[model samples]
Target: MKVRATAKRVAFGLCVFCLLVYLVFPFGWALVSSFKTNAELFATPARFWPAHPTLEHYRHVLANDDFLRAALNSVFVACSVTLVSLAIGALSAFALGRYRFRGRSLVLYVVLSMTLFPQIAVLGALFQLVNALGLYNRLPALTLTYLVFTLPFTVWVLTGFLEAVPIEIEEAAIMDGASPLQLFAKIMLPLAAPGMVTTGLLSFIAAWNELLFALSFMQTPDKRTVTYAILSFSATTSSAFEVPWGQMMAASVLVTTPLVVLALIFQRRIIAGLTAGAVKG
Candidate 1:
């Protein structure tokens, strides 16, 4: 029996090692490749470590015209979408979690149904709507469009979190002459902080990384987000025949680094928020 258990442990360790390699390898390769020059990158049987490690790619990407603007655009749009989604979602979730209302399940079904709608299917109509609203090719338009994706999930997650908060605590607040607003502000909101953070982070990442809508809605180069900025390297110019892989990868790393840091920082809270209501009634 001991021998069998030891073998099982060995197998589990091997499986975990494989999974970590699978996840880490691509990112490691990207980091390595980002340091390679254009000439070195195409060299046969690419070197794992560049013989002459260079900061050229990072400098070039950062110095590129409109790169900083694009990064700021993405940050602004993402922050806006996350904040708006959290506010609206939290309010709706609180209402649904705390009170019974007519068509409650139906409302949830409708919200979930919106999530099922493919972005591609609505792109044409949404583009027209944005144009009609005179918000075409603007960050606000992208933020609004992102809502179609983030709001549903935020509402769903926050509803679960709010539901998990005990009614007894809320009841006690109510009996202590707490107004509805006071109870929610002083009690429920504090209790739901973890969920809010989790949902907001997810929303921010979604809005930040979204490429398709950013590509479609944004036309001006200076107004483009980081995802759209990648296309700048793909343009066919007299001097360049191929995309700048090193710079593109470097830019991608820059764009994604903050999200990685955020995830590392709050991974535990995110897990707790996701699981908070699962075990509760």
Candidate 2:
């Protein structure tokens, strides 16, 4: 029995090691390849390590005006979407979670339905609407489009967290002459902070990494987000289609760094928020 258990433990550890390698290998390769010259990258032996690592790709990416502009565009659009979605979602969540109005469940179902809809399904209609609003090629267009996804998700998650908050606390605040606004701002919002952070982080990440809408709506070069900018490298004048793999990898690392740092910093909050309503006290 002890021999069998030891074998099982060994098998489990091997499985975990394989999973980690599967997940980490691509990013690890990208990190390594980012520093390799084209000649070294295309070498016959397939060098795991560059003969001579270089910082030129990173430097080039950092100095490029378009890359910098695209980074700023991503930041602006993502931040806007997160803030707007959270503000509106919080109110909608409070209403849905707290109130027992007509069609309340229906409303939640509708919101969930919106979230589940494929972006491709709404692409044509959204494009037309953006053009009608004269927001085409604009950063605000991305922000507005992002709301279609982020707001629904935020509302649903926050609603769950809000529902978990003790009703007794709300009643006490109301009895103490707390108006609806005071109750929400002071009591409910504080209690649901973990959920807000988690939802907001998710929303921000989605908006930051969104590619389809960013590609479809935005036409101006400078206004494009980092995701779209990555593809821009594919169309260099050096050749009809010569992708700068090194620079692309370097840019990818830069683009991914912020998200990694964000998750690392708020990982605890994310876990706490996800588990907040799982067990009722």
Candidate 3:
């Protein structure tokens, strides 16, 4: 039995290691490439580490005004989407979780089903709406479009978490003359903090990385997201023939590092939030 257990542990460890390598390889390669000079990058045999590392690519990217502006644009759009999703999702989740209403199950199913549609499925309809509202080429257009995807997901996840909250607490609050809004503000929001952080961070990352909607809605050069900024390297340069792989990699690393940091900081909360919804006491 001891021999069998040891073999099982070893097999599990190997499987975990393989999964880690698969997930980390692309980001690791991007990080490695960010430090290398253009000459060393495409050299024969393709060395993993640069012989002489330099920070020129990072410096160039930072110095570019359009890049900085695009980063700001992305930040604005993502934060708006996250904050709106959370506020609206929390209220909807509270209602659906705590209140019994007609077609409640159907409502939950509809919200869940919204996630099933690919972004492309809604892009055309959204485009016509944006143009009709005269929001074309504006930052708000991106924020509005992103909410369609993020809000439903937020509502769905938070509903499960809110459902897991103890009903007695809410009842006690009501007995003490706490209004529904007061109970939600004072009692439920705090308990849902972990779930909020999880969903908010996920929503932010989605908005930050989204290129299709960004490309479709925003026409102005200054209104693009950071991911689009990476692509714009070719367009802004004096020579169209020149490819700035090193700089582009640096930008990718810059864009991706914050998300990594956020995940690391909130990984425990994310785990707790996700698992908290899976089980009900």
Candidate 4:
């Protein structure tokens, strides 16, 4: 029995090791490929290390005026989406989680159902609406459109978190002369902070990486986001008649670096937040 158990443990370890390799190998390849020169990249069988590592790609990408503008547009859209989604999601979640409203389950089902609809299906209508409002190709329009995908998920997750908070605590706060606003702002908000961070992080990442809407809505080069900028690298041409793989990869690395750092820094809080809602309930 002991030998069997030992074998099982070894098997589990091997599975985990394999999973880690599967996830990390692509990133490792991208990182290495980003440094290789155009000649080195297309060489047969591709060497793991760049024989002549250079920062020319990074320099070229950063030197472009449009890159900075695209990055800024992405940041603005993502930040606005995250803040707005959180505020609206939190309010809706509290009503659903704390109060005994008629047709509450029906309302939640309808909200969740929105997530099932493909973005492409409504793109035409949304584009027309934004254009009618004179917000086409604008950052605010993109931010508002992003909420269509993000808001439902945020509400679902936050509702779970809010429901996990014991009602007795809220009652006690009320007994202590706490107004509804005070109870929510002081007590409930603090307890729900972790969940808020988790949901906001997700919303930010979604908006940051969104490509379809940005591509469809924004017409001008300057109004594009990072994803659009990256696409431009492939779309636009140089006199050389070759794609700049190294520079594209470098741009990708630059764009994703902050997200990687954020994930690493908030790893603990994110995990805690995800589990806290279920654990308390």
Name the candidate that leads on TM-score.
Answer: 3
Query: What local lDDT score does residue 255 receive in model 3, on the 0 to 100 scale?
Result: 96
Model 2 steric clash pairs:
none
lDDT of 3 by residue, 131-207 (tens): 99999999999999998889999999899999999989999999999999999999999999999998999999999
lDDT of 1 by residue, 1-281 (tens): 99999999999999999999999888788888899888889999879988888989999888887889999999999999999998899889988888888999888888878889888999999999889999988889999999999999999888889988888998899999999889878998899999998999999999999999998989889789988888677772235777788888898888878999999999998998899899976
- Once fitted onto the true fold, the runs of candidate 2 whose alpha carbons sit more than 4 angstroms away are none
Residue 126 displacement in candidate 4 (angstroms): 1.7
Winner by lDDT: 3
Residue 137 miss distance in model 2 (angstroms): 0.8
Give lDDT per model, in order: 0.89, 0.92, 0.93, 0.89
- Deviation of model 3 at 180, angstroms: 0.7
What TM-score would you give candidate 3 relative to the actual structure? 0.98
TM-scores vs. true structure, each candidate: 0.95, 0.95, 0.98, 0.95
**Clash number for every model?**
0, 0, 0, 0
Candidate 4 regions exceeding 4 Å error are none
Candidates sorted by lDDT, descending order?
3, 2, 1, 4
Tell how far residue 33 is off in model 2, in angstroms. 1.0
